[model samples]
Target chain A: MNSAHSDIDRVPMQLVQGCLVASVQVELSPEVLHVFQQDLLEAVRRTRARATVLDLSGVSILDSRDFRSIERTLEMASLLGAQPLLVGIRPGIAASLSELGAQCAGFAAFSTLERALEHLDSAG
Target chain B: MIELGTMQIRDEEAPVQIRVKVLGLLVSLGADEVLATRVATAASELSHRYQLLGAESRCRCVLHNEYSSLLVEFRFTSAHPHPETTDLEGIAGVMRMGRNGTGTDELVVQIKLPMPRDGLSKRAIARGRERILQRSRRELMDELRAKNAELEAYNETLEETVAERTRELTHANEQMARDLSAGSEYVQGLIPDPIEEPVRVDWRYIPSSSLGGDTIGYHWIDDDHLALYLIDVTGHGLDSALLAVTVMNVLRAGSLAGVDMVDPDRVLFALNNSFQAHHHGMKFFTIWYGVYQPSTRELVWSGGGHHPSILISPGTEAPAMLEATGPLIGAVEDMDFPAERCTVAPGSRMAIFSDGVFEIIRDNDLVWTWEGLVEFVDTLRGAKVPLADALLQEAERIKGDASFDDDVSIIEAVFP
Candidate 1:
């Protein structure tokens, strides 16, 4: 915890007119992932949001377990009744994740944040 | 005219006393401190210049009150050689120096000034002489003490400055220690917990007492396949730690592109291509990666400039060395790392370690090489402590301390 000050900084969360967006940065360490889960869920419950987007545009490198944790967090957000959408998965990462046989079939992923927001708005 | 003073300028202190007497005489004649000091400066300069010639000179002061002006004269005579007196004019305003005779060493320096409102009298001249004679030795000692006090104050200031700088340096050292310890803890956290269900696995890693990067871990690539890896970056500190972390993450997650996640050879090849030395500050790393299958009890392993691991079991008479040689990852691209496979017999034990474990100085001041380490591992039969812990303890004991110069890392897995 002492040397992890900079890494433990909060995941940037924004509430966009009833939709919550949590931006993910690089270095998906376990401590950061834990904080990410706590921060995203707390933000979702507090806002009573209709849509939730976990932005992965900033992240270029992720491991298998970190990917699993991200997907599981998204699922939990859906259970809380918010429509969860993952946006901006890098093409290189997408290819590697698919090759590694990670379960990405159930995730609602989009190529861009704009497309994800449009889908969420249309669904409402 | 009144004869103010006369004394032989015998040494350095005489000229100083002469100058003061001249100042007292001027002040007694109704001159202010500034006027008195100006005359005193002239007297002091003339006496000092004559003293430097190493000649015994006699100085006499005479004051004269004329119609509207007063004259102060210093008459000097030396039995030995004398210095030229032309520069005396600059020191004494309205003053001039002249030789008493063409072939003699006698010279007279005279300064002319406006007479005071009141004419000079015997009473005033007598008062100046009495006060001059009354100046005692204690007053001189008091003056010296004042100067010494000033020097002591400056010395105290210097001592305080040194103390402040020392405190700042100590603080910086403490900060560095805290940061390094925190980094060590974080890297240690990257290792996955020991496996219990399929096989009993444990490890010991002591990062260089300072901060160096040495990483080891075992994780399941899938339900049936388990992946294990150990990495040693070339250098130490922050860059090495970051590279170690990134590499371990890529290996544990099987996150490299076109990498058949279960194949040890493909993983090494991909890592070599992705992290060529030129792209990474010319840094290289050694790695031992293996994939273990529980159903078959077979381990597929590859190496890149890393030490070979050891496999020993109750049934085998001799310990088997699992050796795989390839160019160091990031050293040569397109390196074809040969994969080696070995089936684990029942109750077999596999041991893997970083170079720091074996490359240590013993009590005989000789380095224990890989062969020596292999021989030592072969003898650890029925040891009270587990093999991994025993190896670490032995390494520390041989080195005479736990603070190794390199990161000491060892992983031992007992097959079910």
Candidate 2:
């Protein structure tokens, strides 16, 4: 297991049933998110799965650009016929995201990768 | 009829002869060669004027360099023979010359041959000799001290010169250090880290030193489209770093115009045009650019004299290189970018890297080919990975843990 520098960086791809499950350890900083936007879009294209579970466990903070990048990724994933499910939203980030009106309700949210997988499995 | 009293040879002598003899005596007490010669000539001439019979006299003197002291000898012969003759004198008045000390360097005695037994003449000669000696000693000491003081002044000047030279060298070194620090900061400022976004794009930029020639930037065309670019100026350090900044600024301005083939190609044209216009004639850059549309999963890319990009598909064991269709930017004006499009399926990866990655040599062999990079990406295909970590590790592994020889910048666009 690559000990990710952050909790939100998704390097080790784990497949859960039909869902592409990844624990993303990201800095949640603007610079990381800018790149994350493109990186996630490409990661989804390669997984060949319709659903994704994102673990934001490593992100200690989230800026406006990061919030925007994730929103854009979710939109792109939807266009690609895959749904992006966010997990490991530390309560602080959850509040920040909600306060920013990030419009994340369009995608699924979970507290952990396992729970997210369970949700995906149940929904499917 | 001037009797000239010298027949007495100052019976003793006449006043003129005595004065001249005294001056000669002073010379003998250690006056310089020129002064001693002049004194002796005056004494001889004075004796001739008197025409004293059998009046024979000689004077010899030695002196030091400063003419401050003198040693003199005086002798006299008289025709009349005296039974009671003595080389002695009685007390005489002291003689002083101007503001200086007593003038004579030494004193001389002449015995009157006409049976004169007076002690006065002996006392006068003895007094003159003593006075002359004291004056000579004082003058010699003063001259020696003056010469020593002049030498000390000269030595002080030499010391000051040495100190000034040392200060100049130290100041120059400090200035050089400051310039290096400023140049380093300028380079760091030129290359920004990857911009963060919610979408999966990750990047890494490492300059070889504090300064580098690599430049990277990204601009959002709208909510769904983005434009990215990287340029590596041709050289290292300050000059190259400045060129990279120039290209970055030009690209940024073009990006602000909105997404169009007209935009990327026009930016390229402006870069080359501006570089040529300057004609300082020593700077140019190799550039690569891509426009990504997340909604369509299409990337329009153009390359100029840069490393080809890697495109990987799910389940594919190799990666494809997007080779340049045009020469490096800044080499021509009004050049066509002719953007290429690649459709990445969900979960595919595209790696954009500088030539610093491919140019690395190991054991005299090129480390890895474009195909090898694609295969590396294929390994990550089944797994969900953040693009930055995977690329950094692979780059480090290929370079054998050696620091990158030049600036290394990599961007991975993951179309999720």
Candidate 3:
């Protein structure tokens, strides 16, 4: 009985002084991809914030399919006129993004949610 | 190349007769003037007498490519017959080739008039060749269009056949679904509902599919004696359901036949015998039969290829498992499933369940151990809620809120 539970990423999303801060969890499986799509879309529609920080520190095995599904979520956010900032990508995931070629073309990335927030604050 | 019949003009006799024979042969063989001019002038001079009409007509003749023929431009045309015309009678007329591109097409004609030679015109020859070529092209186009239409009709028929097959397949699938629903209902009917007395017995059976081979039954063999049995078929669905029905039928029939045959061992033996006699070398079943005599406070039970039954003390916090000591039913000749009798104290409760209850997993672990089950029984030993409620809760937990991989059955009985 090997009882090793998957250590999934968890995002602690909150509104700090009217800035929306989102923490992301593990890359969801294909079976639950639709759930994240709907949730992200709904959040973007409800909050007309100027910037959103997407946290992804806990994601372990993000692949091309995950990238596409996440891209759809980001597209939905953009449709609501919100600026999405990527944050907390692991070093391994970043290398994989380059290897997959064209799947991540022209996508923005960042290291931490705090840094993404600072960058947005400076631009604002 | 076209071969013409030989002409019969005699040698060195009539030069005019030889000339007409040479001209006719060239025309029949479709030779150009350049080729016809190759014929010997001696032959042409001898054949020259045929072109002379009643009046002299000036004719210029030239032999060009071969020694066998000549080209003659004659300036004579008349309705009057010629002196050498009888010699041309032995030669047959021209044989025109069919327009199948299978014959030589070397013919060319140009007639000139120094006299009244207006009968054979150049425009008439050109029109005749144009008509033949036009008819051949039109026939080819019509054949191609007919073949294309035939192909389209075949494709339409193929599409229609595919649609018809799809409809038939969908109909069969719908019928199969209906049969399964009916089978589930029929199997559910075999198990009795909660007993409507002070003694509460709750049983749950969750089939892996709409129809599975698990059966649980409750019956009163006689006054103060209640029999509870649970049987699981070795396989799933229809085969198991059929076997369960057969076992139920045989037991009912044996009981109805005589009182002596109503014993649990006797009923099971009869079922095993029937299986051996009729369904020999085939299927088998696991059954736990227990007869509870309220008057004697005795639970007379027998096990055959079934999981152990859990017995919980009425007013205590402990439970025990009664393991089977007999072979599975329908295994060999004269196989007898031995019976075990235990004294039941008043207010003592017991639960009989299948392996399905113990096989469930939760959070990647078996839901409960036998020790855990004993502790669980102790928790609900004297609760205000009925034993049926507690058992249903336990079953639901074992099923992980209705998620199970196999059939589940649990029968709880509290002795009076």
Candidate 4:
């Protein structure tokens, strides 16, 4: 199993400076992706965070399917009262997405998690 | 130098005939297949370009037997000024623009191939040329008769093979599991191969012993129309597969009388009247039938209680779902399966699949929904993995194993 999920039912979400931050670290199986979606939405609803920063620095195999899943998740999270902030996108992943003509033009992305948090903080 | 007579490019078939002549010449001279094909392609392109220069244009092909190599030259002449080296896409060897600064509309192209150890004698060259000449009427009739006889023998053999396989399955019914093991190749032979030209089509089919009777096929309805469909009959095992194949044959042959099967909705209506569940072995089928018109770039589709097919747009816009909501075929007679039409832009893609493509049981013991499939495929635009393989892989991932409980069929067509 190429599942990055350490636990089946749990998805780790942390809060820092009144914002929720979750860093994706490995290739996620379909089950893990579903679980992550559920857990992220629940955390957003519970903490009522203004911004949620998702870091993708550790995920190297970012294929189109995963990229699209992340894109949908971001839109869903935004609808759930949390401004979704994507950060830590590797250069290779970005280049691949553009090369394959993936729809990356709709969202604004950041180079680092701290930069994302700083933007959120300054916006506030 | 053997001056092979020049032929006029009267129509589209002229270039093809010219290609055949050059190919035959090089192949007879011991040129390798690759080199022969390249030189033939270059000759055909050069001649085709000459034809395009207006009605007063023509090309002559000459074969020059040299000491070390066989040199082929295409001498092109036209009343219209030859523009910029007769654009052959730089396909072959040495291309000389024109004649001795005469500024005449003549573009000469030369291609060389290494000569065989023993060069052909004059008599042998003439013999080869004779062999490559167009066949006489009597010769064509003789070839046609031979081909027809061969086809009849092949059909008889195929029938015997199918009959023998069926008998073995029926006799080993008590040992059904063992007999079913040999059915993988038998089922594979019924599926169509991937098509590349006119319209690019590819599909993935995975059959488990417990999940049979899913068939996907496409055929030209006319010179400009193509019919694409996926049919899934009820139940499992060899009986259901036979039924599916029967229905596919019916569709492929367009044998449903009194109705034009080329129209998608009409085909469904006719099928409903023909294969009712209660009357026909308690089996009903769900099918998504669509027709593609290359001339109009239109796709008209209708379904009998099957899942909606997805049409991915050309650009980054979200995909349009072609909803199909009629009742299952054979479940109800005279069911009006309404058809809808949409224009397919260049670079668009269509994915018509059975329910098994998206309706997988997840690890959480929940069946996947069409919405999940929509979102998944939406991201699959510009995906690294091929569409059919990617869908199957994702289904296996969701199910936690490679074994599928139902037939997994995905047919993808890309319009360029």
How many residue pairs clash in each candidate at the backbone level?
0, 88, 21, 0
B1-416 per-residue lDDT for model 3 (tens digits): 21122222222222323333443434433543323322312233223443333333222222222234322322222234333322222121221111214432211122221221343234533432332223222235557879888988988998999999998999987887787667767878877778856455777666665466678777776678788888776766677778877676555444434434336676666666667524633677788888887777788887788867877676544565666566677777578777788888776777787666666667787776655665676677557565545665786767568756567667777766
Best by lDDT: 1
What is the fnat value (0 to 1) for candidate 1?
Answer: 0.00
Candidates ranked by TM-score:
1, 3, 4, 2
Compared with the true structure, what per-residue lDDT tens digits does model 1 show for residues B115-159? Answer: 877766667767765754544343566678898999999899999
Please give the DockQ score of every candidate, comma-separated.
0.00, 0.00, 0.00, 0.01
Candidate 1 CAPRI classification by DockQ: incorrect
Worst 10 residues of 4 chain B by lDDT: B83-92
**Worst 10-residue lDDT window, candidate 3 chain B:** B91-100
lDDT, model 4: 0.75
lDDT of 3 at A36: 56
Q: Candidate 2 lDDT, tens digit per residue, A1-124?
A: 2234333333445666766665666344333454566666676787777787777886544433356667787778778777788888766455444443456767878787788777777777
- B3-104, model 4: which lDDT tens digit per residue? 765555554444555666666776777766555555556665555565666565556666788888888676777677664543343445577866623656
After superposing candidate 2 on the true structure, give the runs of residues whose Cα lies further than 4 Å from its correct spot: A1-124, B1-103, B107-198, B255-263, B277-281, B358-387, B394-404
lDDT of 4 at B127: 59
Models 1 onward score TM values of 0.53, 0.43, 0.47, 0.44
